[model samples]
Target: MRIALATATGAAVLAAGAAITTVTPAYAAAAIADIKIDTTVSFIPPSGSDSIPFTVKVNSPYTGSKAPDIKAEFWKEGEATTSAGHAASVTALSDLANTTPAPTPASSVEVKGSIPVSSSDKPTTSTGKWTLKVSAYPDGSTTAVSSDTATFEVKAATRVTSANVDPDPVYLKSGKEVDVYAGFHLEKFGDEKITDVRLESKDSDDYYSLSTGLEADDSYHDSTSMDYSTSTGSWQLRISISRATKKYSFTKAFQVKKSGSSKAKSKITLYASPSKVKKGKATKLYGKVYRGSKAWSKKILKLYFKKKGTSKWKFVGYVGATSTGKYTKSVKPKYDGYWRTTAAATSLTSGSLSNIKFVDVK
Candidate 1:
C-alpha cells in the first residue's frame, strides 16, 4: 500500500509539471488583457517644463492552473516611436514581476509600478501618447507569452488660463465702508472640470476667499466684498487656483478714498401691478420718482413698448404728473413678448425703471 501511494504522488507531480509546460492558456503570452494602467493625470510644474505620472500593472490569465510571471514597460506610439528610445528605458521604474505563490484558487498573480517625472525627460515637450505594455510568461518559459498596453499624455509645465484679481482698483475714504466684488477669468485643456481649488488673499484674515473654477462659457463672480470704512488706504487682492495640481495666480490693487457726509441719497420707487405680466396683453404701469429729501412733484414720464420680433419701439402713451410725485399710464401690448418702461425723472435727477414684468399673451 505504501508503494502504491508513493507512486500516485509522484505521478501527480509529474502530471502537473507536464500540464504547465504543454497547456497554452488564452492569456499565456503578451496580450492587451494582461496589462492595466491609470488613464487620468494631473500636476503643476514650472514654466517651460513638463512632468507626468503613470502606473503600470501586470495580470495573469484567470483560467490557467500554473500562475504566470509578468513584466511591464512603457513605449512611445506614433511619431514619438524614436524619442522613447524606440522602447521603454529602465529609469525610475524597471521591468519586474511577481515570483510568489498564488494566493487563492482561480486567483491570478500581479505586480504594479509607478513612473515619475525624470529630469532627463524632455522639458516642456514629449507631447504624445506613451503606451505602457504588460507582458506575461509561464514559469520555466524563456519568452513572454502575452502582453497588454495603455496610453498617457505629457503636457507643458506651467499653465495659466484666466488669471486676474477683482475689486480691481477701487477708492474708499477713511471710516467709509464700500462693498466690492472681485472676479477671475480662464480657459484651459479644452474645458477642464475644475477640481480642488485654493485661494490666498492679501491682508490674510482681513480679506475674504479667492475665486477659482470659473466655467469657460459662463461668467464667474466671487462674492468677496471688501470694507475700508475703518482705515482709508490701498489693499491688494490675491487669487490662486490649484486645478489638478496645476497652479495659477494673479493679484490686483484697490484703494479707499476719504469722504464726508453721505450725499443726499435719492431713490426712484417703481410701482407695477400684476408683477407677473405675460406677453400680448394690455396692462397698467405706474412709476414714482422720489428724492432723498422730498418726493418729485412734477415730471414728464413717457411709456413705450418694443415688440419681441422688432427693434423699433412705439410710444404707447405718456403719464404727465398732474398731482404730486405719482404718475400712471395704461397701454396695450403690440405682440406676445416682453416689455420694459423707463421713467425719466425730469422733476428729480433720480431715474428709475420698473421691474421687468413678463407678459405672456396667447
Candidate 2:
C-alpha cells in the first residue's frame, strides 16, 4: 500500500512539471535605436504669428505593426523647470504604421510638427538660447522609449525700414563747409537698444567718419568740412547702426559738385613724335598738361595703349610732368597701337583725357 501511494504522488509531480515546461513566454517590447530633431529656422523672432516648423526622426528596432508617437517641447535653456505654459508645445504628429518587418536592422520614420510663437510669448532677455526636447513613445503608450534635445536662439527682430541722406547732390563752394543730414526709420519686433550710429565715406582718399549716440527722435544730423582741398567725385555715405550683438549697415550715394569760380577745368595735349617706327625700335611720346591756361606742373600722368583690333586699353606706364608741365617718354614698339594720356582730378581741378595718337609698327 505504501509503494502504491508513492507511485501516485510521483505521477502527479511529473504531470505538473510537463505543464510548466509547455507554457509560452512573452516577447520583449520594441525599443528606440536612434532619434534626431531638425528645424527650418535657427532663431525665432518676437513678433507676429510665426510658425516654427520642425521635423523629428525616429529609428527603432521594433517590428511591431504600429509606429511610435513623437512629442516635442521648447523652452528657454535655464528655465526648463518653470511652470506649465512657460514652454511652447509642438503640435502632435499624425500616427504612422510601421511597414518594415523583422530581419531588418532598423526602421526609420519622420514626423513633422510646428510651434506658433507671437509677441505675447516674448522672453525676459533680449536674446537667449532655447532648447527643444523630442521623445518617442510606443503606440498608445505614455512611456518614452528614446529622447533627444536640440538648441537654438531667440532674438529680437530689427531692420532699417527707411533711410535717406539730405542733399542728394551736395553743392559746396571752394573753401566752404556744408552740413549733411541723415534720417532713419526702424521697424522692430521686440525691445532692443541701439548702441551706436556712424556715418563715413567709402573712399579712403576722401575720408570722413563720424560716430554718435542714438538721437531721441532718430534724426541723424552731422556736419563736415569740404574745402578747395577736398577731392571731388562720386561719394557714398555709409550709415552703420550697432546693437549689442549685431551691426547693420546701409549706403546712400551723393555727388559733390564744385560751385565756386575757382574751380578749373584741366586739359592734356599728347603726340607721338615718330608716327612710324621699325619693330623693336624706340619712339618718343610727349604730352603737356594744363589747368585752364596755366601749366599744371609737377603732376603725374597715366599712359594707356590698345592694339588696333582690341577695344580694351591697357596701362603701359606713367610719366611725371616737368616744371613747365611737359612730359616725354620713349618706348620700343611691339605692335601697332593707339596711345593716350590721362590726368586724375585734383581738389581744385577736374580730370582730363588727351587725344588718342596712333603709332605704326613696321
Candidate 3:
C-alpha cells in the first residue's frame, strides 16, 4: 500500500508541471497588431498654421469587433525615448462601427486625423529632421499591441509679401488692332526669381499671355495684342504670379476704346472728289492719313461700300497712301452706296478706319 501511494504522488506532480508549460505558450502565442502612419503635409510652415494630415492603419488577424486606440507623439528625430518623458502628443479612439476592416486573414482599420501645427513645432531656422511615434492599443487596454515611427524634413515657410500693378491705364487703345501693356512688381521676389506672370482678359476670347523680359531690378512688365470687339465694355485683368513653391493672383478693372493706330496715333479721312455724280460715270475718290498732326506716309487704305438703306458693307478696292499721306482712286459707280476707308494694319500700327459717309449717286 505504501509503494502504490508514492507512485500516485509522483504522477500528480508531473501532470501539474505539464499543465503549467502548456498554458504559458498559449498566452505568449496570442497575436498583436501592426501600425503604420502616413502624413499629407511633410513639413510645418513658418508663419501660417496648417494641418498635419495623417492616416493610421492597424493590422492583425484577431483584432475583433472592438477597434484599437491610437496615439502619436512628435519629437525631434534623435529623441525616440522622449514619449515616456511626456512630449507633444495626440490620441484617437477609433469607433469600430465607423471603420471598414479589410476582408482577409488579417484585419485592417484606417484612422484619419490632422495635427494643427506652425513654427511652434520647431524654429523656422532649425534644419533638423522631425519624427512621429505611433502606438496602437486595444480599445479598453493601456498595453500597446503595436508601435512605429515616421520621419520627415520640416521645410521653412515661403510667401508672397506684396503685389501691385504698375500704373496700368484704364483705357487701352483699340481699333483695327488692339494692344495693351501691363506691369507689376513683387517686392519680395528677387531679381528674375519669379517663375511666371500671366495677364488674361475676362471679357474677350483672346489669349494675351505674356512673360517678363529684361526690366528694372525686381520689376515685371508685359505687352501683347488682343482681340476686343465693340461689345467689349469693362474688362478684368486676371493676373497670376508664381514662384517655385507658391502662387498668387488678383484682378483689376479697366476699359478699352478705339483710340489710335497700332504704332503712332493717326486720324483717317476719306474724300469723294465730286459732291454729286450720275450712275455709270467714272468718279475720283481721295483720302489723306494724318498721325497726330503729321502725315502717315505710304500705308494701304482698303475702301468698303454699302448700298443706300443697307447695313452690310462690301469690299470695293484698296489703295496706297502717298508720301504726303494722300491717295486717289477712280471707280465707276454702278449704284447709290455709302463709302468708307480704313488704314490696313502695318507691322508698326493697329491701323485706323475712317468715318462712314454717304455718297449721293443719281
Identify the leading candidate in terms of TM-score: 2
Off by over 4 Å in 1: 1-32, 42-72, 75-79, 82-107, 117-128, 135-146, 152-162, 166-172, 178-181, 190-203, 210-225, 229-362
CA-RMSD of model 2: 16.6
Model 3, runs deviating above 4 Å: 1-64, 73-123, 126-131, 142-147, 156-158, 174-197, 201-207, 211-221, 225-362
TM-score of each: 0.38, 0.40, 0.37
Count of clashes in candidate 1: 25
CA lDDT scores, all candidates in order: 0.46, 0.62, 0.54
Top lDDT: which candidate number? 2
lDDT string for model 2 (200-316, tens) is 433323556665544675545565656655444456766655444445565667665556543558899998979999999989999899865657778899999999999999999
- Considering lDDT, where higher is better, how would the candidates rank from best to worst? 2, 3, 1
Worst 10 residues of 1 by lDDT: 1-10
Single out the weakest 10-residue window by summed lDDT for candidate 2. Answer: 1-10
Error of 3 at 37 (Å): 6.9
Count of clashing residue pairs in every prediction: 25, 1, 1
What does the lDDT come to for candidate 2? 0.62
Candidate 2 vs candidate 3, TM-score winner = 2
